[model samples]
Target: MLIAQISDPHVRPAGQLYQGVVDSNRMFEEAIAHLHALDRRPDLVLLTGDLVDEGRSEEYAEARRLLAKLSIPYLVIPGNHDHRENFRTAFADHAYLPATGALHYCIDTHPVRIVALDSCIPGLHHGHVDAEGLAWLQRTIEADREKPTLLMLHHPPFTSGIPYMDSYRYIDTAPLEAIVRSVGNIELVLCGHVHRTMLKRWAGTVVCSCPSSTTEIALQLAPDAAPASYLGRPGCMLHLWDEAQGMVSHVSYIGKMDGPYPFA
Candidate 1:
């Protein structure tokens, strides 16, 4: 099955801009339109995190409107910018995130099982997976050991080398590592909170963090990194997987800009 993994949309209301330079809502609209235009649409659209700009009701209301236009099924977990209650309100009809108010859930999606975790620490920018969430994750993975499962969360369990961003990652990773080590069927860990794309591995599972569709974080050297912005590209990933073929992911940036293939 093919899954479209879109992360860190950071969507604001229409015509609402963040700072003087970021037209986040417009960027997200363009990206969603791109997905709708795809010839062979994805089987599912998995939004890793950052559904709203500031966890505001209006922001999520606008977000809901834009996302509702997608033709295929979609699932979203909470990011640092999302409030659990507001997120639940926006996705009230989603089976995984019931109206009961919990922002986490697990689903058996054909060949793959997906476990979505809520790592948002409410008002904090940094993230953590508390004992309850961890326990649920352990039980969830243990229940379905044969299927190739994917764990989606808002924070990476490891450092991404971009020091500024790394500081805001999951504060405690030992417990997460233990759970991942025990679950042999976990194929990948998908996350997005750093506003930049990064890939790492933990307990033999691939940990991937995709870039924000609106922009990107600068790739900076540690000592000199000093909280800065790079304004890189707007993009998303296409994840292809099956029992026979396994999981393969391709990252693509928006091609609306006229330019030559720089690498070639």
Candidate 2:
């Protein structure tokens, strides 16, 4: 099975732009068009987080409208920029999401099982998985140990070198780490919120952060480099799972590029 992961669209209202620069809605439109045009379309799409620039109801409504155009099934989790209530209300058809409390659920598709964890702390930019949330995760993973599982959350569990972004890294990771190490079937931990593509080995599994569908965080790794972003190549992660190769992920940049020139 093939799964496409898109994150950090940060979709703004119809007439507004994200951060006064990015036309996030347009970017998402292009991203969706790219997905639809793929020769081998994905079985499903996983939207990690940051669905909108603000947690406004109208923003969520706009995001929902755009996402509805996808031909394949899709799932979404809350990010720091998302308001749980608004998101739940907007995507009411997504029954996996809890009506109240944290938005967490387990999806059992054909080849793999997806365990989505809610790491968003309301009214806060940083992320945190409290004891309760961690406990839920532990129980969920422990219950299904044989399935090839993928853990999805909005925040990266490890510290990224980007100082400005690292400051908002997920807090209280020890519990989640312990759970992940204990459960050997977890194939990958998928994350967003940094607005850039990053990969790290943690807790006996690979953690990959998908680049934003709208604008990308500058790859500034210096200790003092301030936070900045640009409209670089928007992208998504395509994960393929099969009996032979297990799970393989590829970064697919959106939009058309130059010709497929021969290597000389």
Candidate 1 segments whose C-alpha is farther than 4 A from its true place = 100-102, 257-264
TM for candidate 2 is: 0.97
Query: TM-score winner among the candidates?
Result: 2
Best by lDDT: 2
Instruction: Give each model's clash number.
Output: 0, 0
- TM-score per candidate, in order? 0.93, 0.97
lDDT, candidates in the order shown: 0.82, 0.91
Error (Å) of candidate 2 at residue 240 is 0.7
lDDT tens digits by residue: candidate 2, 192-243: 9998889999999999999999988888889999988888999999999997
Tell me how far the alpha carbon of residue 7 in candidate 1 is from the true structure, in angstroms, after superposition.
1.0
